[model samples]
Target: MQPTSELVFAQLKSKNSNTRCFDCDTKESDWCSVSHGIFLCLKCAGKHRGFGVHISFVKSVTMDTWQFKHLQMMKAGGNEELHEFFDFYELGNYAPEDKYRTKAAYYYREMIKTVSEGRVLDREKPSIDEGKIIVEEQKRVMPQKVIEKAAEKDPQNIKALIGDAFEYTKDLGRNIKEKVSDVSIADVENKAKEAFSKIESKVDSWNFKEKFNSVKTKTEGVYNKIAAKAKKAMKKITEEQDFDDSKLVEGEDELMLDPQGKNGKK
Candidate 1:
């Protein structure tokens, strides 16, 4: 393949006035060659394949930055130049020479900065009550204070030591509830059951039954509410004429009951 400039040089000098290509125009001569040929003229071609276009003939450090550049160009905030830079930045050749490595490094640095700025790290902290822990993460600030506390008491006074070490029950409850608010109720119930089982192991069998029944009652109430809402939505959809029967039948296992024939009372 002839170099881009050579191809353009030949096209520009070609006798046919038809050689001039226009990107915005559909004229046949507007694009006599492939690639940068979409727009004719030395100046436009220079801007695209030469001039400000960065071509790294070297290949030392990773060229991963170029890959990210392409991705960003494909997803940039409407920056045409940056998109083009990403698209054709590696026009010349790659490997052996270490020239392009510098340019590649520059783009890689930009990518690292962009990625770092967009990420948030997770941190774990001990809760005040000491019975539970809090895991936190966000754009800024430490979560240590919310979880851990310090207290001092003379060894001679056990009551005072317990009092100082124990977090207020109300405060602990509020903090625990808030921490688990994002988890599903089922998850909370599972955790509670596990804890209950742990306690039952140390206690008599009769005590376990009462705790189990209490948990079951709460779970049933939740299940009833969810089932009721789902049934209501299904009823509404069944009443709608536009609902596709074929698609409905495709999910037969999900249906609560067989669809009675088209007639009433099914």
Candidate 2:
């Protein structure tokens, strides 16, 4: 196969309608015809094709050296060898053993590795940082309007939270409904007993009365409607059944004729 630089030169040369690589077509005009075949012009030939490396002894060059300069700055900060390697690249100079090029590639690999690790570590523990951020946010004092404004600015977050809450409640309801539909009356009573025990534990142990009261106050209107329905249901059930243990334990009183009655009257 042709060398990478030769391939690039051929590709660029094919850019011109009037020009074609000895083996292919190109439309670019910056290619020069050498003895054996077409070659890249001085500028294109010296610079790396799409950021690989530079070829020495091409003539005039046009590729920006800013990235190389920035690399130099980084080397100045702490990478001494980086500076030397970059100098080698910038001047189109290479050692006989490819030492400069190898060192530069090594440093580039390390930088790439460092960046990759940073990204992986960042995503792996986002929630830890996020928790700290949320805590700081909670500590910050702002007007209610400001809080609402912030939420409005990030409407996607608000929408996402609302969607999450809706999905959670919907899933919960579906699960409970499915369980209720499949259970016998006895199972319903057992589950209700378990739920009551859990509620009692919460009521007895949880000390957030202020928080509970605030929520209760906000939901008082809905609570009133529910309470009314519950009272009506309780009243209906009580009317159909007697709660007197005496009536059940000692059957209902009966009046009989003198044959069996204590008062011997007809």
Candidate 3:
């Protein structure tokens, strides 16, 4: 991670698309999101961090230590590849509620749709304009680091996915049976099987396990800080209650605080 940062910065600089921020195209870009595999300027980087690391993992190209896998993801997609996949009407279409930036929307909805289909990422594809052929130049070669969920080994997660698929299948089977009162049990079973197969396929296809882990860890940290502050507030309230009885109540103060009389014959 230490010396690898230097290598990452050098690789990113080699591309023209990496020259500017992928989000705002701002000059002097220095930050990036490892999750989405896009470079970002300083300000947009803050927004990505705010989105939570699970959705977007922001890191400095020069300041932060780098991992080899992180660099590979960045190469898989930068401004050029993302633009080609998204086909943005506006160059910097970032907003406060950037659905396009969310992990589900980006990794699953749009980009995944393209990948799942027969079509490739369209990186080297040519776009025709006025009958003039134009081919997008390949800036840098990307690694074959596949996108997958890191949670495949967790049995609980696997069970949850299968459970969800079953629930959906049940609903579909019921609907089919209702539409045709004479529909046989075998027909309904077939429908359920198809439904389960499609659902299971989607689950297996979009495995985003480790990316979410990074976000989950940071989210837990934020909650832990809040819990600590809540405990401090409770302690202060307890102290305040003690002060109230000591200063305001005459007979009740000893019973509430010490609960013993020093002058008593014990």
TM-score list, all predictions: 0.18, 0.16, 0.39
Clashes of each: 4, 9, 6
Note the Cα lDDT for every prediction shown.
0.28, 0.29, 0.46
Q: Per-residue lDDT for 1-266 in model 1, tens only?
A: 32344343354435343343332222333211121112233222222222111221111011112233332222221112222433354422332123123343234334433543454323222222321112122222112221122111122332232232222221222222222223344554454344335433543334334433443344333333333333433454322211111111222211111112221121
Across 1-266, the per-residue lDDT of candidate 3 in tens digits comes to 33366666687688888889877777756777776667787667655655544456667676555666666666555768766654432323435345444333344233433543435565333232211222232322111121122334443454454345435533553243222223333454455445545544544333433433332333233223323333443344432111111111232111111112232222
Ranking by lDDT: 3, 2, 1
lDDT digits (tens) for residues 1-266 of candidate 2: 42344344344334443242222223332332211122343223322121121211111112212233232222222223333434544522443224223434434334433443343222322232232221111221222442354355444343333233233322332232222223333443344334334323343213333322322332232223223333443443333221111111111111111111233221
Q: In candidate 1, which residue pairs clash?
A: 21-30, 58-99, 58-100, 126-147
Error of 2 at 6 (Å): 99
> Which of 1 and 2 is the better model by lDDT?
2
Error of 1 at 189 (Å): 16
For candidate 2, the per-residue lDDT at 116 reads: 30
Model 2 segments more than 4 A misplaced: 1-154, 166-220, 238-266
Per-residue error for 46 in candidate 3, Å, reads 0.4
